[model samples]
Target: MMEKKLALVGNPNIGKTSLFNQLTGLNQKVANFSGVTIERKSGTFSAGNQMYDLVDLPGTYSLIPKSKDEEIVARQILEESQRPDAVLVVCDASNPERNLLLFSQVADLKIPVLVALNMVDVAEERGILLDTQSLEKWLGCPVVAINARTGKGLNELKAAIEKAKIPDLQIFNPQAVFSDNSTAEIHDFAHWLSLQSGQEYQHTESETAKTDIKSLQQARETVYRYKKIKEGMAAHHIVQSRERGNEFSFDRWALHPVWGYLLMLGILIVVFEAIFKFSALPMDWIELAFGHGIALLEQALPDGILKRLLLEGILAGIQGIVIFIPQIAVLFFLIGLMEESGYMSRVMVLTDMLMKKMGLSGKAVIPLVSGVACAVPAIMSTRSMAGSRERLIAIFVTPLMSCSARLPVFTLLIGMLVPARAAFGPLSLQGLSLFGLYLTGLLGAIATAMVLNRLMPEKGRSTFVIELPPYQYPLWKNIWISVYQKSMSFVLEAGKVILAISILLWFLAGFGPGEQMETAYNQSLETSLASGMQRAEAEQIALSRRLESSYAGLAGKWVEPVLKPLGFDWKIGVALLTSFAAREVFVGTMSVLYASGSEGETEMLKTRMLQARNPDSGSPVFTGPVVLSLLVFYIFAMQCMSTLAVSYRETQSWKWPLLQLFYMSGLAYALSAMVFQLSS
Candidate 1:
């Protein structure tokens, strides 16, 4: 059955998306149609026997088309063919006057509407008593009070909607209803608003124009008076209470430039520690489980090229990429949680001062923080940033943040080099090393931004402006859905790339130039037989030998000489090159490569990496320099394929991505070379 469509709309930062998520649950897809980059969030929910399509619109202050985004949003509202069945306006209960002004504007469209008085609990806590009934009567629409975080009043909101029938509203087009000459006095507001509306106004120099401006001033005053009447005085008192009542003032400490930065540092330290400590167990389990499954696939398939492709290449690549899904999901979830709560605003407020030095709008913090998950979405978040220079700068520098995709490489290398033993205090030396890796990556991003700011100076004066949203607990369902979607995309998209590469890699290392692979396979078969071992172990040994003699290994060996000075064996060299497309591939490549190289250990892959040796030196290969070099390379390199593609698309040119590739590769090379030279 075709579902009725409803849309949730609101000013930016008011919990509208959260409410949409709560209604739709996990049945949602975020995508863009046509030109705009705003997330076109559409989902289906079954309220009764009927299904409904709920679209969560981009949050904006008004339905006025300004930039590409504002234009898209405004056009959607005005289009007669695609008008929603009903529109639900989400408003901050504590900030009703501003919200009501917009609400009245939407109500003028003559569509059946619902006013969601969000943050009502926060409003009440500040001694603001919201008369929802009065609000409903004032707007002639259903007024629902909801705390999207706690799931409060959701059922009532839903029931209200179910009972919803379209009502006729008086269309009040402000432009049509009011026109006067005194536009000179409020010229700034008019110009700012006209830009949003995409309208051009003609001004003339005359006393009559002054009279006209004064008349328009009177029109605006009339609108204000009507707005107040539409919103009861009692409700005004409630909202005013909220603005003045909160005792938890941050002006003293957390807002201080010095103290704010310190607190931010401490918060980041905790975040880094939590990501490493919590995700380790799940990651290990994924690695182990996939390892066993791949082994089984080898045994079940025939001893030929197809089996090798299926077992080695596809499986290897998938396992290489999918293992990091948990970490990526965790990172996105945590960031989303921080954003849903009001704390994100405070960070932006504090950082705008420093961001100015970097030629970024304070709003650039959104993209930068989001860069932790992946650069593509992070770069897209710059839409909220007002100025072109700030957005461009954000796009340029966001790639340097170590994304979740790099976590696997860092973990793999850290485990390979730094012993898991505890260091001075309770901290594991490995954990501290991981923390250092994060710092290195962050420093690289900051340095890159600093340099870029100096070189490509902004043409216009760009200032940082960010809204401080009220604090609330993260809705778990909303967070889970967000985490799940991003994690799934990483698996489905990167998984395909890794799977193909892994299989090809497996084939190369699985089968060799000729007899060496066959001969090794035969000897393993004979040894397993001589020892009377099971068919499975015998098969494993054969597969291992075939890989040792395969093209991938030969490729690794041929390149080993070139990489030896870079503190990498041919195996490490091949892994490094392949890992350019994906850092997660490092772990997968090592697993497959080690499986090809090793003779005996059929146990855990992690143990194999720990015990791995350099063929020439006959000593453990993963020394501090080797690991440090590899980690440093990943820290600066733009390794994610998706990120490169995004950079190309955003800039509408390949120049940026190509430059990114050259500079990152050069930086990785020089830094790794240094680490190797100093340590060796």
Candidate 2:
């Protein structure tokens, strides 16, 4: 049977996406809409014998085009070819009036739609009672009260969808409210909408002169709809109870200028500490597992390049990334909690004044905050920003926000340099160090934005308007799904890059040009013997020399001089080169490079890094100063190729991305040099 197409529509931040997730489950995929970079999410599901294809349309406040997202929604609903078999209009049960505007507009287009009254539980908590039957009667369609969080009322919603049909009554008649001169323009617009929806225009032309749609006529239409809606709502008793509740009382403290910032800081500290402390045991287990696996493979497999590739190359690289999954999951889980609780919006409000001063749109806060997860998506979120100048600045500075990819890198280096222990009460010392690195990124972004704001031409004023969602306990199911998706996304995306680089690096590090590797090995044996070193130690030295003379080593040496100023050796130089593809790959690159030389050593990557010695000076390679320098560099550097590509795509110009690359890299080098030199 052919699948019926359904478009899920709603205002931003409602339960639309949650409902979509419940309906489609794991059958969804995200892609770009035709000829546009805006993300399109669609999925398929089977209900009984019939299948359905559900597309989650971009959320908008109205049918009238105000933004790119709104324009797309408007076009999709109005255009006959693109209209779905039915549109599912998800509305907030608590504030039905605001959402009803959009729903009424969609109903006017004559499409079959069912109102999924989401968050009814939240509405009940706020003492707002919704009369579904009254609402259904008033709208002339089915109304399903659904709690998208817990899958409540889902079966009923699905049942409603199967029998969905066009509304029995029109919500408003524009000609009834519009004056004579504007009646013609309003009638023409109605005609246009009908023609676009593939319906015959039935309105009589009381005025022959047709003109353009004016703001005055649009205002009259909106005013009339709301007036009729208010009367009908009272008549039908759709909203049985109303109360302001304690939201304002909570917001007073949460949005306070002083206590709010302090609360946010405390929350962050607790989160980071939780990440380090909670994930430690799991991380240890992962490391131990990989170590045992490597040992077993060593004992079972015969000595050959295949064994070496599997053990030192593929396994080592993957082990580095996999060991950090617990920490990654914990990080995302905590972030989800903050977002789900609606506290994140308060944080945005707190930073609004400061963001505007830095020449960012007040709306730019979302993109900047989202940068903490990953910059590629964060940069894309800037499309919703009102001004071009604001969007450009946001894209340029977003990568400076330390992403989850940098989490592993920071955790590794911090684990090596700082002891994992509580300090100054319950706060973990290592967590503080991690927090400091993130703070550095935020400060860097702010400083860069101020500079860019001065240099760039101002095109338009940026307006900041955001509604604070009511506070509620995070739904554990939603949190789990979020954490799962984010964690897997990181693993799958980073694993591909790490795997390919690991194999290529193994080949380059295992074999050298000509007889250089052979000569180095022989000379290392001779030197070790003359120094009276043990046989095992001498063999280890020989392996190290062979690696130093290999192609990868030669490449590292070529860049060693430039990096030496930051207290980084040739091995670090190699890791730096690989990390340009991805910041998280730094850990995997270090794993492969260290594992190849330490043949037969199955210790964790942390132990390997901690025990590393400078080839020339014989001093520890990752000293406090050097590790600090490395952390500083990663904090500011534009190391992810994906982010740069996204920036290019978003800006539609190489000029911005290239400038971003050079500018951020240069900043990273300068800051790292200063950190190392000053600390030394």
Clashing pairs in 2: none
Off by over 4 Å in 2: 79-81, 119-126, 171-221, 234-237, 240-243, 299-303, 361-391, 403-436, 564-571, 582-631, 645-656, 674-680
Per-residue CA lDDT of model 2 for 1-680, tens digit only, reads 89988999998778777898899987887766766666678999877788999998987777665455666787777667877999999999888888888888888878898889998988899899989898998888888999998899999888888777777647667567766564455453335344233111222344346433444455677787788778878998998999877755778788777888899768866875676688889987887888899999999999998999999888977875676578767877877787788877787787788998888855776677667767765676677665567788999999999987798789889988899899888789997898889999999999999999988865445556677878877777767877776666556655566666667777887899999999998998999989989877677668767877898788888999999889898989878877776687677567656653332233477887888887667998889999999999999999977677777777788999999999999999999999999999
* Predictions: Cα RMSD each: 6.4, 6.2
TM-score per candidate: 0.78, 0.83
Q: What is the lDDT of residue 382 in candidate 1?
A: 73
**lDDT score at residue 81, model 2, on the 0-100 scale:** 84
Q: Compute the lDDT of residue 350 as modeled in candidate 2.
A: 78
Query: Runs in model 1 with CA error above 4 Å?
Result: 46-50, 66-69, 119-122, 145-243, 247-253, 256-259, 295-303, 366-388, 403-423, 427-433, 507-569, 587-628, 646-653, 674-680
**Which candidate tops lDDT?**
2
Q: Give per-residue CA lDDT, model 1, range 331-428, as digits (tens).
A: 67777777766667777887787888888756778788777767755776676666656677788778888887787678767776777899989889
